[model samples]
Target chain A: MKWALSLCLLLSVGLIFTPNTLHALPEESGKAELWLTKMSTAFSELNFRGLVVYGDGDHWESLEYRQTQHKGTHLSRTQYLSGIPRTQVRSGNELFCIHSGDHIAGLTPDVFKPLNRDLASKLTTILASYEVGVFSNIERIAANDAVFITLTPKSDDRYAYQLWLERTTGLPLKADLLDIKGDVLQRFQFAELELNVTTPISMFSSSESGHALRLKPTPDRVSSSEASWWPAWLPSGFALQGYNKVSGSEGRQGERLTFSDGLSSFTVFVDHVENDLGPDLTRRWHATSATVRHTRSNTGDFRISVVGELPSVTVSKIAESVTLVDQLASR
Target chain B: MTDRKNESLSALCDGECDELEVRRVLNQFSSDPDLREQWRRYHLLGSIMREEPVSSIDLSEGIMQALDGEPMDEVPARSQTPVETSVAHTAADNKRSRSQWLMSGAVAASVTLAVLVGARFAYDPSALDGSMSGAALVMNDSQSAMESEAISAITVAANEPVVEPLTVANADISAEELRKAQEVLSQYVLEHENEAINANEQGLPTFVRVANFGADNKTAVRKD
Candidate 1:
């Protein structure tokens, strides 16, 4: 009887802990960090070609995407498929836009900015505000089986996320942005993907008609910190990533402050305009929305716009909180 | 059933009908059970007569079933570029296959047939005209649908596409607002898109590729 009771106790103990172990989050294994790190590195490391499809409300679009790193220069091309021909090719820090017969190259210094440390540091910002867990769910994308990682935010400042990482390559083949209600706000996924495909030199060549337009020089960029302004309040988990002051021709000046919670980010642009062209126009692209609000500050008429994947109302609140502190006062 | 209705079904089976009759028959497909039954029977009879082994080739029901059972979160599309340049894909495909086998005979002949038809379409310059706008396929919530859909399968190999015109999902905006929005939006979008896309962050890069200046729309897949 004593031996039998001991055996029963062991069986009960095994049953008691088995479910908990099976259902355990990846916190212990650190697989969440591993998966996220893989996702961040996959794009730069892998040379691939694929089509990405996304749609919202009415307009849905697909694009042919090609990414390659030649001589340490990353040449990624995004070609729009459904409409008139407009293409953007990002080679290192320059974004070359070819439309119709016009070739406009806008230099982006931001891309070359040393990744705010490694991708891990950037992820740490997100991990600070979000809880990472593996759903133990797998789905097929681009004919590859992808495992799902659910990012539940530690705070409600941002939306929840579910990233589908291809197991073999650890690349993110698909991602969905969900609302507080857990409804999907946007989805960006690769419908057809072939990795390690040899990209032709001409594929990265300029427009179909190589007749060239002048490469547009970047408007002057100053620091956003010099703008002598800061938001008195911001959503939880959001921090000032960076800001730049922009000066275009004819002396039009604007300062932009960027904030990020790792997963979601928004830019506040205080552009000085000649006229009152401020309409709160909101555009949703995939999961991100750009809401532009025109307002007037003490200096003159300014258009304060917030562009992000976050809710318009939430961003609007951030926009309303922009206060111009004298650059001198902060010191 | 009236003989006239039966005749209409026969014509529809034969792939002959004006817009009016096509609409009428299409309407009948949903409302009239007798019409549907007759339609099925007519196709069945024709298949038997033709001596072509009959098959349940319909996939709409399967597609609907798949859609119904599917969980909403995961779906993907083609590259950031997509256009109806199925013609381009077809052309590149020919070059691709021929170059693959210029010196070797190991490649299958079926690939040759597909290339030939694709080449024919590619050679027609008018098909390449900017004016020829077929309804670009909208892919939502089903990357798997690409495997089942022949057109998308063909498009996967298409190449050298034009940039897409600025179009938004929100269609309620007037053309003026859209134009203005595009002007204001594009100016900001370039800077913001650059900021959002670059510097090795996966989240922003993914969002920017799928949003802002979006991917080509034609070769994309949809997920709900």
Candidate 2:
């Protein structure tokens, strides 16, 4: 009886010192959040060049990537390995996406960036929706001691993510998107990465063989605003990032709205559904998903498409909540 | 619109009619043309529900009726879409490698019938093909599931002749209007993805994806 009592006392003492699995102690949670903020900054502040293997579903690509900060401006570039020549180079706000020696359809880099100047605060705001914690055991990545940090989604509206950060520099060494079953749906890991090395600024310039495409029809200019409809309900932490209007063939109107929660984002598209037929066009891409919904009203029938790195149900809820902004105000 | 005797005839088809109503329906079946037409339709529908082939020698009439009931032109023409093009390219490795689709000659005939329906009208031609019997059985409840599966098979094997039931939906929506809509939406696709890429410190992740996308989508356009 004395031995059993001592064992029970020892086990209880261990439990009291150890943080709970789902809910970390306040000090532990704050430290984890601080690490996440550092991870975000380390990626930008530290100059690194390495080969990264990115994956989504069954698709895989090997990319030679580099990021350099010179004179307070960020410069980044990515080149494909052993395939048709495709590259994207960004220097601060100037963006160039070259495909087969031509600038294909794409928006400016700033369009996708969060509206806030401070990325850390945006991440902090999103912490409400996630249960952030650090693993007790340290992991190794690319020859570096790393801490495993997990952002387990508090709700099903988002996916859980595990990121391994270099212990010394706090740079993200590996990232994985996990499904409810803890299965990795997407992964980006540096097979070989160099840390805190000075990079040549000219490395950010596009050096592809083909001439860049003329801006005759520059895609997604966000030049006009014919977006009469807006979603009444948005998920917690999501905010209206941007909106644009493009004139369609023969004077038709189309609207695009973007929303983001720092780490993830989605876009809603509204247009007239002229003779809309057949099944909803649902497709999943590397870390992205697209779903199209057809909505009908007395005034007209509309085709609503939601695209993002978000859960399908969340996107669907956002899409279903869309209503004509002017129409709602008047009513 | 509910004709009194036709309603009685419908009731008799459900096996719920009293003896007197059955006798009345039987007595009128010989003289009332509309009642006879309803009886024939109910029987045809019942066999379709049972997943049994309709013995209609003139399939053209059935095709025409199916087209009339479900407008073929009203489908959202979503083929040749950038998203699908990407899908086709990524799945190219797993796409059917064999040039010949392995199925009975009758199934091939069914595929030809689907093409004929698309060429003549906008409705799912494969549904009119002999496989329509199976499609009709599950279509009412799980309509969208069956339709998308049918559409994917049809779009993938568009150049090949291999048709089956539930693989006959025609999404040959009007091209120009569809291109306009897709063009508008593709912008959002890029914008949304671009934003995600922009958030990346190095743009290593999303930037390469765009390139792979370019390569994959190019294959889609070329194949299409």
Candidate 3:
């Protein structure tokens, strides 16, 4: 009894100094959420110059950029670092894409269509899909200090990401997209960065502003009266965003359809004639990911191709539904 | 008997004991409560190094020396400091190796795909054949029979019955032939665009023209 009592006393004394596991601490998660919120806000409010290296598959290219925020307006200029003598300067809704080699002026109604609020929402959703975590210490980036955070995706559909954001401004210093095996599929890093610089208004003006603004011919936006005869088995989360009807030689006719998942978009083209001849085009192009599938409708023989980043099943379902409706018909 | 029970309790805390022994200790601890407190104390001793500063021995200098391989004999207080060290040091090597393993796996997959494609086309004889005409397919050039004839000759020389390589090889065809192919592709794209617009005017979707753009940003040019 005496030894038992002594053991109990010693154990109770030791219990007073025991430390808990890191998994039990709430502070690390707090740090992750705080860092991401600051990053999102800073991207919209801060003016920072940094190199953006965009890559897909084996191709890689770098762009030099300058951005300035004044009052409520943001202006940006970008020049390709590679072979092309091209420069893009944007001010609000206007974008001037200049090709120095051809002396051609490329004009667009809205240069930075990606700066919309919907894009922000999409990015928020994308980030939330990952396990948010931080590294142990900060690292220097382009002469400025930055903090690194690792985000591991919970699903296979998306890739993991490691981002280094500026410690002071929350601007992204570098980003790497890693596959399931943790190999980097793509990387975007800043070669140089200038934070909070005073940019002149003239910097936003394109050198080709005096030249003619050549507008690419807008596509005809007309839907076929035959859309009513189509079926309705589109994939979940896919919404019809656009459609048009076209008439070609020998009365070769088709209707094109567009779909969007609120972020990534795709298109489907359904060509038909009042004959038994099946679709002549049944192939796919890597440049567009357009998969052609042919089917027969009571009114005509149709050739359909689904084009987008989505799975082939989604495209197939949408392609199966090309109906024909009279102009004045009601349900 | 009491010492043996405490030893078992410690083993349970370390996750070395069987479930039956764990249950027995848990039951006894639940009734007495003090044994449970003792088990936690032993684990804490091993974990506390993660959080607190050491006081009695020069364990920190020992750790620093172990990490950086510098002798800390110059420190005068080595004898007085108590060591408060963490077991996490032992696990660092395991974590680093696991991350490296994952990185290598991903690289292997991508690299294998690249190598296979490269090797398959490395000795493409079509590009070297003189009769094989090359065209910059994106330019609006006319596709004459000579370009077709050149493609056939090259295909025959390569002895590959597949026509897929022919299409790919034609991408580098002469500027004029490339112009014609670009016109064909552009016409196809415009046809689809026209269809989308017509559908939209009738209250349908209008977002089809630029929907599926791959990394290839090449556009078909029609020169007058």
Candidate 4:
């Protein structure tokens, strides 16, 4: 009888204290912070497989890609669903753009200024820059319960974010890429995700799987003492990352210049105009994120194309302000 | 007794009283200072409840000092029992799990919509070229299509000088070979342009051109 009375007393005490303990707001805040930290950590460290949709302008395409980061090496395989089926295999900085009629070998610079580290560290910036607090209760994501963390953009330069990360693995199950107007510009979601699965080496194909034209060793591949000849009035935070001089089919030389603004990059091309006249007068769309600008000088007509996830104004500005320094004088 | 009425008056501060009760309370407070004191007491209790942190609120030093004066220190100290906390947590966890299930379904539906729409607009380059002007170069009467083709092909390969009318080779090569050679050179130029764009480097190097083949000498100028 004495033990039963004591147990009853303990149960009442527990019931009374439970509400008081649950009412503490700091504990809830701590839980949210932990969830965000875990989500960021997995993005960089984990190997992920999923289908992604990429779009620019009106051109949108769905693709299946797998990204693996192991032993400090990053590899990806991209398969396109368009005509003359193509597959792009990338390991580290190298990519093979494979196709039936043609295959092109490509290289992107190291220290890809955009998304500097992995996706994980980028999320930390999201938490820091925004007043990150749960706007409501837990939300559903990709058939799993996820905390819907909506980050309102404080500035007009960038977009807002609505991230849905998994409750278990803390991986981003789905993400909505938004524009300034809060409209969904693009969407990258995991239709299916497997974490830490045994991946086959054969899953990665050599870029040479398609018919390859015997590529001549391009003149741009040949090193020259003539890099400093051309310079640009690059925007603040932009850096010259690479230089390649390709000879045109007519055996004329063309210059490819790469610049990056810590996160995003733009490519600028300077070629001797093969046509007798200048480039087209009107602006037109090539792809979603690509804009081409043409200018003429006494030397030759120049074609400047700026491509990236940037405002078109930014690209056009970069293209127009470019000035070529005389190689002989610079040397 | 006046304080009891003032306690009711305190409830009146929250605009909780209905219209009839509000009139009654207003009439009663006007005549009683003792009722006013009760009203003050009621206001004080109401403020304290509002001040209780619901979510991560920082307690001011004064508030902490007031809390220090309370006799509930022993109760808060005992509040952190792991087993008891976990019991409340299980219920909350169940709620969260349901929410996750709902969110996942929404995400799957949204992703399917995005993918199906995205697949419709694959890049088609030929379809994109809407502006075709009269840009093709016109050939002179002295230049036959075969000779012109051969000259363009040579120019495409090594930026070599265009073949002059006077320097036409008597060597027999099929017209089909000449056309094939021209196509190969055109493709090379396009590929080279793509490479330069991707590399984002220097300008295209100078190619050799014949310039003006003099009517008398027909000399080729090897310009850099």
Ordered by lDDT, highest first, the candidates read 2, 1, 3, 4
**Per-residue alpha-carbon lDDT of model 3 for A97-176, expressed as tens digits?**
66633321111112122122234444554444556777655566555577777666554433455667779876766665
Collision count of model 4: 33
Model 3 share of native interface contacts:
0.00
Per-model lDDT: 0.51, 0.51, 0.44, 0.40
TM-score for each model: 0.53, 0.54, 0.45, 0.42
Query: Tens digit of lDDT per residue, candidate 2, span B68-135?
Result: 56443433322332110000011112223112221211222333244324323334354344442222
Residue A219 CA error for candidate 3 (Å)? 19
List the candidates ranked by TM-score, beginning with the highest: 2, 1, 3, 4
For model 2, how does the per-residue alpha-carbon lDDT over A153-253 read when each residue is reduced to its tens digit? 77777777777777877776667676565555565555456777677777777765522221112233443245678887787877666665644434566
CA RMSD, predictions in order: 17.9, 23.8, 24.5, 30.4
Count of backbone clashes, every candidate in sequence = 54, 5, 51, 33
lDDT of 1 by residue, B101-163 (tens): 221221122222222222232333454444322111111223213222322222222222112
Instruction: Kindly list the per-residue Cα lDDT of model 1 for residues A1-331, writing each as its tens digit.
Output: 9999999999999888553324534554388888778776777777888766543212234567888878887777777653445676766655555655322222211221222114555787778888887656455655667776777777665677666777877776666556665555544556567788778756776665433222223233334546656766788788777766655335666677787776677878776665544345665544455666655667776666676657656766776677677733565
lDDT of 4 by residue, B1-224 (tens): 54456445433432233334444655665576666444432322212112111121111211222223432223232122211100012112234333433333333233222221211111112322344211111112322233333222211222111221111122353555333333322222233233322332133222221121111122221121
Question: Across residues A124-146, which tens digit of lDDT does each residue of candidate 4 receive?
Answer: 54444444444333444333556
Interface RMSD values for all candidates: 16.5, 16.7, 16.5, 23.0
Which residue segments of model 4 deviate by more than 4 Å?
A1-44, A53-60, A67-76, A79-99, A104-138, A144-171, A205-236, A279-298, A325-331, B1-224
lDDT of 1: 0.51
Write down the RMSD of candidate 2 (Cα, Å): 23.8
